[model samples]
Target: MNGGVLRVKHHLVGGFSTVTLCPKVTDHVREEIKAFLLNKANAKAALQMQQPAFDYDEEVEEPRPSQPNLKKRKGPMDKFVAPTPPDVLKGRKDRKDIFGVCDKEERDNACRAIAKWFYDAAIPFNAANYDSFKEALELVGRYGSGFKPPSMYELRVPFLIKEVEEVENQLVEHKTEWAAKGCSIMSDGWRDSVVQKDIINFLVNSPKGSVFIKSVDVSEAVKDANLLFSMLDRMVDEVGEANVVQVVTDNASNYVKAGKFISV
Candidate 1:
C-alpha cells in the first residue's frame, strides 16, 4: 500500500529506490509466544467441553418477545484507543537449501510476521479469505527471502503500471464479446457516506462479463436530470450507441427521468 512517484523537473526517473526490511525478534520472545499459544489452545478445548448441551428434543415452543433496552449506550470515545507507532520491518534470513524444512521456531516467527503486517496495516480480517491472498503468499515463498520489496516510488510507477496492464489484458476478452453481441450500458449512482459525495459508476455488460468503465464524482449535477441524461448519452456514444442494447440505472427519480430521456 505504500506508494508514490518522483520527478526531476517534470521528467520521470528510470531507477527505482528500494528498502531492505529487517525485523528482529529475540529467541526469548518467540518462546513466550509459543507457550502462550499452547495455553490458549488448551483453554479453548476446556471452554468447549464446559458449554451446556442443547436439548433439541424438548423444545418446539415459540420464543417470547423481548423488550428493547432504552438505556443510554456508551459513547464512541469511551472505547477509543490511540494508534501506536509500527515497529521497523525486517526480512527473515533464508535457508541455504532451497527445499529445506522449516523448524518450529522459524515457523512461529513467520506466522508472527504475517499477522503483524495485517494488524499494522488495518487491513480487513476477511481479506485473508480471498484466494488472491493465498496465491500471493505462495508466490512470495518461492523466492524465499531474496525478494526486495519496492520503495514508494517503484510501487506507484512501475508496479502500478504492471497492475493496470494486467487488468487491460483481461478487458480485451470482454471487448471482443461486446463486438459479437451487443452489450448493456449499466450505471448507478450513490452517495459515498465516508467522502460525503455523490459518485456514479458505469459498466459495459454482455454474455461474457461486465467491465467497469470508470467512476465519476457527480455530486454537483446529481439533481439535474438534463445533465444526467447528457452524461449517460456520452457514455452510450463512447460504447457506440448502435451496439448498446439498453441503459440500466437505479430507480432514483432523477436517474429514472434521465434514463427515459435517453430511451427517447
Candidate 2:
C-alpha cells in the first residue's frame, strides 16, 4: 500500500503455522526508508555526544559487594589513622605533672637510698627485674601514672661513677689536711675468692681516719720484691714521702724486702 507489494508464504513446522512476507519496494519507498534510518542514526549520535563519555581521570569508588550478615573489616591504614585512647593522653599529662610537683630533695634522698640498698647489700643488678621493681615502686607511691626508674646502665655506670668521684674528692680534701701531720701506711695482699687472683690493698691511717689508698693486682707470675717496691714507692710519692711516718706490711718475705728498699 505504501508503494510496495508484499508476497506471503505459509509453512507448517512443529505443528505451528509460520508466515513470512517478502516486500517488493518501489524507488520512492526505498528512498523514504533510507532517509528515516539516516535521520534516526544522526539523532542517536547527537544524543550520545551531548551526554558526555566516562572520564578516565576522575576517581569513582565502586560499591563493594557485601555479605548478607557480616561486618566490614578495617584496612591497615584505617587502623593506623585511628585516634589514640583518652587514657593515654591523660597519662602523658599526669606524668609531667607528677615530676613537676615532686620535691627535688625527696627525689634525691630516694635515689641515694636505692643506691645504698644495692651497694651496701652487695646485691647484683638484674636488668630483667627493672620493670617489676619500677611497678612496685609505683604501687607503693604514686600509681605509676608518672614514675620512671633509673636504667640498668645509669645505675651501673654514670651514676655510680659520679658518686665515687664525689666521695674521692671529699677524701682527697681530708687527706690534704691530715697528710701534713704524718700517716702510718699499711699494705696487705690476698687472693680474690671468686677469681682466685692475688691482690694487694694499701691504706693510710692518719689522726683523721684510715683511708684506702689503692689496690694492685699481683696475680702475675712476677710477684717479687721489685713489684712490691714499685707499688709502695708509688704510694709514698702520692702520700708525700715526708708525711709518711712508718710503712707497715704483712711479714711476707717479698713485703719485708720491699720495706727495706723503701727505707733506703
Candidate 3:
C-alpha cells in the first residue's frame, strides 16, 4: 500500500508541473525570467503599431495658377503739337528788321530808327557787322512801333566807323603807355574791305594787357617784305629801342629777317 501511494503521488506531480526546480534555485531567478517574457511581448506589439500600409495608386498634384500681364498701352496723337519758330515768338516784324537792312527799302528806315535809339540810350555800337545790327533793329521794332528806320548801309557805315575810331583811340593811348614803359611789339598784315592790305601792329607790355591796331599803316602791297619791314622799323624808332624790349612776329622769312635786324 505504501509503494502504491508513493507512485500515485509522483505521477500527479509530474503531470501538473512543466519544470522541476531544485532547492538550490533562488527567487530572483524566477522574477528575471518573468520580466524578460513581458518585455519581448511589448516590443512585438510596438513594432506592429509603427508599420505603415502602402497603396498602389499615383498621388494627384494641384495645378499652379498663371500670372497676369501688366504692359502699358500707348495712345495715338502723342507727338503731334508743332514747336513755334524762335523768330515768330520774338515778334520780328520783317526779315530786314531781324537781319538788318541790306537794301534801301522800308527796312533801311527801320534800321536807322534802331540805331538812333541805341545812340540816345548810349548803347555802345559793338555790333560787328550789318547782320548783327539787323538783329538789334528787329529787337527794337518788337519793343516800339513809332521808330523811323534808316537805310541799312547808311545806318550801319557811320556806326561802324565810330566804333572803329573809338577802339583805335583806346589802342593809341595804351600804346603810348607801353612805349613809356619798356614793351614788346608783334605785327601781322591782313586784307580788309575794298581789298586794301593793312598792317596791324600789336603792342605787348609785360606789366599790362596787349594792344592791337593802336596804329595802322596802310600799304599798296602788304605782301612786300621790304615795305612791311620799313613800317616795323619806323614803329620801333617811334617807340625807341630802349623802350622796345622785344619784337615778335610770324614765321614769314621777311618777318624773321626783320626781327633779327630789329634785335641788332
Candidate 4:
C-alpha cells in the first residue's frame, strides 16, 4: 500500500478489537471510506436541518433606556426685555414730584379742598389720597378758568364745591322735571366710606319727545321695603300714580319684595 498504515489493537477491559486507518491507506479503501463518511455527515446535517429549532423561552429582551429631558436655554436678551412697572405707580410718582415743593400751609389747604371735592363729588377717600389730590390739582390747574395768586391757592376747595353743587342742583332739577312728566324708577344698593350701604335710586323714561336718567342716594336704612315704597309713594305724590309706569331692579330678594309691594 502506498503511504497507507493499518494498526490493530485489543482492549483488555472489554475484550474489543479496534482498527485505525491512516492517510496512506490503499486507494480503493481510502475512496470507499471517504464516500461512506461524506454520506454519513451529509445525512446527519440534513436531519438536523429538517428538525424544528429549539427556542429558549427563558431568554428575556431588555427595555430600551430612557433619554434625559433637555430644556431649551433662555437667550441673553430675556432679562432686558422684561415688562416695566404699571403706569398707575408712575403717575403717582409724577404727582408726588409736583407736590414735593409745596409749603405745609399750601399742602394742607390743597388736601382739605381736594378732600371736600371728593366728598361732594362722591369720590372715595382712599381714591382721593395725597397723590390723587395732587393729580386732581394738576388737572384743575390745566383745565379750570380764572388763575389767582399763590396766596389764594391754585385750585381752591370752595370753587370746586360751588361747581359740583351747581352741577348737582342742575341735575336734580332736570330729574324732578322728568318725574313730573312721569318716568320709571330703578333703585339699587351701593356702599360708601361714610355710609356703609346706601341706596342709589335712578329714573328712566321715553316719552313722545323726552328721555332722561336721574339718580340720588338714600340712607342705608331706607333700602328696606317700607322706605323704598315710601320713596315711590313720594314720587307718586309728586307725579301722580297714573303717570308711573314701571320699576326695574337687580335680582336681589329685597328688590323683588319691593316690586311686589309697589305693584299692590
Candidate 5:
C-alpha cells in the first residue's frame, strides 16, 4: 500500500486470500504475485513460439489407439443423449406411429420424403391431417416395396372416367332405393353474393343417402306462375312422380302459387 493507505490493485490482489494483512502474510503475498506474473508472461511467450511464422503443413503424428480423456472438453453434441420415448398406448389413446417398431432414422427419412413432396408439389399442410392421407400411406405400406404410384394422366383421365362411372352406378342404386322406399325432393333457396345469383339446390334424399341432383341459378329466372309450375313439374318428373312422396320447397309466394297448379 502507498502512504499506509490500502490501494486495492486487481492484478496484485489475485494472490491474496481471506487472511487479514500482517507483516509475515504481506511478504508471502508479494512473492505469490511475483510468481503469478512470471507464469503468465512465460505462457504468453510459449504460445507465440508454438505458432509458425509461415503457413506450413501440420505435423502428422503416428496413429495410436485413442485413450479416454478424463479432462475432455464437452459441448452440446458431445454430451447429447437420446431422450427416452414416451409410452403412447399407456393411457386411453392408441399407440402413435412415432413409437412404432421402425427405426427412428427410417421414420424420419420417410416423413421427410413426404414433406419434400408436399413442398415440391405445392400440396397443402392440411392434406397430411386428412384421414384419407393416413389410409393412403397405410395402403402403400401394405402393398410393400416396388409400388408404382399413379401418373397425373391416370388421376385426370382414365381413372377419373372410371370414378365417374362408379358414381353413376351408385346413383343408379340410389334411384332404385328412391323408387322402392319413396324419396323426398328437397329444395333449399338462397342468394349467393359470391356468384351474384339466387340459387336453389335440389336434393333427392332416401333411406340410403341424399343425392344432390342440381343447382339452379334463379337470379334472373321468370317468377311467373307457369314458369314456376314448369320447374316444379320437371323436378317431380326427374325423381319419378310415384317415388316422390313429398315435394319440399321454401314458402315463397311464387313457389306456393305454383304448387297449387301441381296435380301430384
Candidate 6:
C-alpha cells in the first residue's frame, strides 16, 4: 500500500486467537486500499447488464390475443330534403272560428279547466282574487278567444270537500299499518298569527313516520283543562286507544294536565 509492504497473520496461543498486523497501515495506505476497492467494484458492475425476460410469460402460460379497439358511431343519415311549409298564421277572428272558443259552450269549458287547475295545484282558494283571474283571462283573450272564469264559490266549496275525501281515503289506507306498529300522540298549542286565533295541533307518530291528525280551534276554550283533555281524548279514540303508547305535549300547565288525563 503506497509503496509499503502489508502483511496480516493469524496466531493461536493458549486456545485463543489473535490477529497480527505487519507495517501497520498508515493514513496513505488506508486511502490507497479504499481507492482500489472502489475501482474494482465499478469494473465488476460494468462487465454485466440485465435485460427483461419477455418469454417468461410463455414458460408460465399461453399468450392471449390482443383485443381490437371498437368505437361508437352515429352512422350515415339520408341526404337532407327540404320539408313543406306550414300553414300561414291565423288572425284572431280565424282562430276563434276554427277553435270555436268564442262560443258560450266553449267558454264554460274553459272556466272549468281553469278551476280544475287551481284545485289540483292546491292554490289558496280564499286568498285568490277572482277579479284578478278574470283580468288575466281577458289579457289572454287578445291573441285567443275570451273565456269566463269560474266564481270562488264553485272552486272552494265543492273542491275543498273533494280534497278532504281523497285525503281521508289515503289515511284510511295507512291506518292498519299505524295500528300494527303502534304510535305516539303529540299535542301542541299555538296562536295562528294570520287568523289571530288559538289553535291546538294533534299528530300521530309511528314507525311509518308522523302524520297530522287534525287542528282544533280553541280560541274561546283554550285555557279550559277539561275541554283540552276531551279534545285530545277524541283524537285517541279516532286513532284507536289500544294503538297509542304515550301522549306528548308541551310544558304548559293545561297541556300537562291534558296529557295526564289521556294517559289515565
- Work out the TM-score per prediction: 0.57, 0.43, 0.35, 0.32, 0.52, 0.40
Q: Please provide, for model 3 over 1-264, each residue's C-alpha lDDT reduced to its tens digit, 9 standing for 90 to 100.
A: 243532333222221132223345354653454344334434533443356332233121111111011122223331222222233434434544644544446656756876897788888777536685667645554334344455788668986788889988876777677767778777865557686656565555546677653656576455556666787788778666677877778887878877777666
Model 1 agreement with the true structure over 34-61: per-residue lDDT tens digits = 3443344345434534563433332111
lDDT of 2 by residue, 172-243 (tens): 876886667888889999999999899999998888788887888878768789988999999989888888
Candidate no. 2 TM-score? 0.43
In model 3, state the lDDT of residue 212.
53
lDDT (Cα, tens digit) per residue for candidate 4, span 48-160:
44573433332111111111121223345533232212222235446666446564466578678767877899976677456855665564443223434334443477667
What's the distance in Å from true for residue 10, model 3? 99
The C-alpha local distance difference test score for the whole of candidate 6 amounts to 0.57
Measured with C-alpha atoms, the lDDT of residue 107 in candidate 1 is: 71
Best by lDDT: 5
Q: Give the clash total for candidate 1.
A: 4
Local error of candidate 5 at 247, Å?
0.8
For every model shown, the clashing-pair count is 4, 0, 7, 3, 0, 0
Give residue 205's error in model 3 in angstroms.
6.9
Score candidate 4 by lDDT: 0.50
* Model 1: ten consecutive residues of lowest lDDT: 59-68
Q: Candidate 2: where is the Cα deviation over 4 Å? A: 1-147, 156-158
> What is the C-alpha RMSD, rounded to one decimal, of candidate 5?
29.2
List candidate 3 stretches off by more than 4 Å: 1-143, 151-165, 176-182, 189-210, 214-228, 239-243
Tens digit of per-residue lDDT, candidate 6, span 1-264: 222121121111011122223245564654455344434433433332122222222111111111012121221221121111111122334556655645557668877987798899998876457786666554455323323444799679886889889988878766876778788888888898997998889998887778898898888764777888888888889888998888888898888887778767
Cα miss at 247, model 1 (Å)?
Answer: 1.2
Residue 118, candidate 1: Cα error in Å is 1.8
| lDDT of model 5, residue 42 | 46
Off by over 4 Å in 4: 1-146, 149-169, 172-182, 192-195, 198-224, 238-243
Clashing pairs in 1: 21-90, 21-91, 22-90, 23-90
The model with the greatest TM-score is 1
lDDT of each: 0.61, 0.62, 0.53, 0.50, 0.63, 0.57
